[model samples]
Target: MSLFLEYVKIKIKDFFSYRFTLFLFLLIDIIYIISLSVPFLIIYSATEGFPNWNIYELFFFTTTGIITSTLIFTFAIVIGLDITDKIKDGSFDLLLLKPVNIYYHMLIQSLDLRNFFPDFPLFLIILIILYPLVGILFSWINLFYFILIIFISCLIFIGFSGIFISFSFFVPHFDSFWDLFFSFREISRKPIDIYKNKFIVLFLTFVFPFALWNYYPASILMGKIDTSIVPSLVLMAIIFLAIGFFSLKYGLKHYKSANG
Candidate 1:
């Protein structure tokens, strides 16, 4: 635990060390957030009102999606890049020699503070805009479901990133995988309801777990979906977690270190 804290501190310091770089990243993040929200904003304005969805509900989904994507982009993407370097330079072997779990170490080492800084203000802005519209009804059932949605979203994002990074162990060259993953991430920013096919939803929720990230919760909040979907969302998150861990473990077992 102390080691982990120290690692986090070092990461924070590293981030502060590059002020210009940090500013550039923050700028990029702000631009990305604006770009993501614009389409939804345009659609909402064009429609005057979403067929069945209200402003509060739209805000809920949009805010959650932005936060989820921001975290994934900052944390997961950094780790993905680091995985390639570790595999190439044999630093991963050095990590394996440490007392801590290699994956945990890698995860901690990949931490960056710059990505999260912008999200705080943006999230606050969203909350300020949403609170009056949604009202604090405090429904226990809704709260439980909301928490579950957040949990599942985090798991799905982490699991997807883990699977992507693990491919480095087997593929050696992962540029194509990275490209495809980025493209998928871009697509996922849109409301999942945009996809009309039930099969596509099933594939995303059960097979990829992307639906839990923003779609499932948004649907529920808007009253466009049933509460029964929560179970499947939980199950999907668990399944993705299992798959990610096992796949990474398998990849590690096959990793011969560049020297071998």
Candidate 2:
């Protein structure tokens, strides 16, 4: 645990050492937030309401989705870059020599605080907007569901990222992989409810599992779906997490040192 903490500390120090780079990344994130929110705001205003949803409900659902999307994006960029760079430069060898698990080491090395400043404000703004509708007093049950949704969302995204990054073992060029991954992010940003087919929803929620991140919880909270989906989401997260871990392990076994 101490070693993991040390790795996280080192990662923070390294990120801060390039202050200008950090600022640029944060600036880009802020721009992205505005770009994302503006469309939803415009559409909501133009329509006078979200289809099948009132103003307050739309605000709450959009906010929740944005928060989860932001967190996923943050982790994906941090973890993806760390893995890609290490594999490219062969620095991953140094990490493998450590007593700690290599995946854990990679995760710790990817930790960055820069994402918080931009994302947290957006998250808080959403919360403030929703407070009037949901009331200041939160039910413990709702809180539990909220936290669980966030946790599952993070796990599902990071797990998918891990699976993507592990492809470095087979594919020497990760630039294309990253491009593809980011393309998928665009789809994730919107509520999956836009897809009308029940089969598509089932595939996204049960198979890909990204829908569990924000959509499932938001649907339940907004009274669009049943609370029963919560347990299923948890199960899907665990299954995908396991699949990701196994994929990484398999990739490691096949990994040939760059020198070879």
Candidate 3:
């Protein structure tokens, strides 16, 4: 844990050490979030609003999606790429020999210190604005559950990436997995119900479990989710994490130094 903390501290120091990089990232995140909101703004203006949703409601929805995406990207996609890059350069071989668990080694090294500045501030700002309008119970217990759900979503995504990472050990062409992952991620960016397709909704919500990232939890606040569905989502997350763990263990046996 100390070594991991050192990695985090170094990332934080580096983020502040370079003022210009920090500003650029800050600008990019702001612009990206603003631009992405345009479609929702247009829909709100044209139709007045979606049924049971208003401009501010949609704003909260999209903002929450952005925060979830950023958090997942920081932990999963970013770390997955770091693993890929290290594998390509054969640097991962040294890390594999370390006393640390390879999973933890991969997870901690991929931390993107730069993204925290942009994503977290925006998350807080949106959260503060939407708290009153979210229509939840608004108690400390509720708040804790909400935060826990989002954290679980991050675990689900990291599990997904960990499973994807396992492929590199067997498959020569593995980078394309990122594209497939992103395409799947696009589905979770909005309320899964908006699709209007019952099969897709059920599959995503139950089978693939992408909705664990935002939809299921967001629906809890919207007063739309079924109480019975909550435990199932958490169970799905645990299952995926286990799959990722066993996959890595199996994959490691076949791993050879990239140089060899």
Candidate 4:
């Protein structure tokens, strides 16, 4: 944890040293947020409300998705893509020789501060806007669920992204895999319950557990479901944990130095 703090301090120091670069990163973060949100904003503007969820309630889903995606982007880009770059440039072998648990080491590695920093302001704005709509239901338990769900979603994001990048060991230059991975992750961004097809809703919810990112917890806060959320979350935590650990071990075994 001290090491992680030092990494964060360095990021802060770098942020000051390169003000222009930091500004550009912040600008890019804002633009990316706007781009991803415009379609949802348009839909809300046109209809004024979704079928099952009102605008304010849907904001929960929207913010949840944004938060999770930003987290995933930061985690995956910092670690997965870094690994990819090193592998391509023949520098990854050095990383493999570091005397530590490689997976655990990567877990605490430096994070992209800008990736989720901008989202904090937007999240504050969402809370202000939703104060009236959610004030009545804002109890301690609901808040606990909200925080727990967000934390678990981040873990899932990390695990899933790590698992996908693990494929890089077996398939060099796997450009198409990233396309498919992101496409599949896109499903986690929307309110899956609104779909007409119940099977898909169920699949994404309990089966693949994509809904755990936003939809399930958002709906839970809205009183859409009961205690069933417990087992579903437990199952998801297990699945992602296994995938994360298993992928790290398996992928590391296939690792060959650039010289080899």
Worst 10 residues of 1 by lDDT: 181-190
Clashing pairs in 4: none
Mark the regions of model 3 whose C-alpha exceeds 4 Å error after superposition: 97-100, 133-137, 258-260
Alpha-carbon RMSD of each model:
3.3, 3.5, 2.3, 3.0
Q: Sort the candidates on lDDT, descending order.
A: 3, 2, 1, 4
Q: Is candidate 3 or candidate 4 better by TM-score?
A: 3
**Candidate 2 weakest ten by summed lDDT:** 181-190
Deviating ranges (above 4 Å) for candidate 2:
6-30, 74-77, 97-100, 133-138
Query: TM-score for each prediction?
Result: 0.80, 0.79, 0.89, 0.82
Off by over 4 Å in 4: 29-33, 36-38, 44-49, 76-78, 108-110, 133-136, 206-208, 258-260
Model 3 per-residue lDDT tens digits across residues 196-236: 88987987766566676667666666666555666766787
| Candidate 2 local distance difference test against the native | 0.70
**Candidate 3: residue pairs that collide:** none
Evaluate model 4: give its TM-score: 0.82
What does candidate 1's lDDT look like per residue over 41-60, in tens digits? 78877887555556566667
RMSD of 3: 2.3
> What lDDT does the true structure give each of the candidates?
0.69, 0.70, 0.73, 0.67
As a TM-score, model 2 comes out at 0.79
lDDT of 1: 0.69
